[model samples]
Target: MTAVIAEEDINRIRWHCRRGMLELDMVLARFLEEHADRLTAPQWQEFERLVSLEDHALWQRITATSVTDSTVERLLRGCIIC
Candidate 1:
């Protein structure tokens, strides 16, 4: 059965996507595409809302991060101070 997605959920997803988290963006994309057919009316609405955000705002959010770390650094250092 299709699941209903609320507008708030879409906003949250959009926020995450704008944050420039590759992992999160990919996850959300996969989820929406996979369940496209099964989405309820509300779910579809939420998805549409996500698509309506300004490109600049989305880009800024997606790229903004508290700390900058390279992929290799994360893999090897593992975010450990010690």
Candidate 2:
């Protein structure tokens, strides 16, 4: 059976994805640039697989969350793979 992700875990992942570290930010930036048109099916699938989430759900959470006060180190704490 697939493990059910808790709300807290989702939040933590979102937080990390947004504010983890400079390296992560760079990676995400490159991803966004390369996928600007969202036309690459394989890249889209890979991104979803990497995050262990569906695209729509992940985008919704990312768009809804605010990262005004989070720091790289703080977010990194939450990114640890249990």
lDDT of 2: 0.42
The positional error of residue 70 in candidate 2, measured at the CA in angstroms, is 32
Q: Could you tell me the lDDT of residue 33 within candidate 1?
A: 47
Off by over 4 Å in 1: 1-29, 56-82
1-82: candidate 2 lDDT, tens digit per residue:
2234455754554454563345445544544444324324444344445445444554443344455342322233333332
Give the TM-scores of the predictions, in the order they appear.
0.33, 0.33
State the lDDT at 58 in candidate 2. 45
- Candidate 1 structure quality by residue, lDDT tens digits, 15-49: 54443545445544655445545666755565455
Error in Å for residue 35 of model 2: 2.8
In Å, residue 6's CA in model 2 sits off its true spot by 26
RMSD of 2: 14.9
Candidate 1 lDDT trough over 10 residues, lowest sum: 72-81
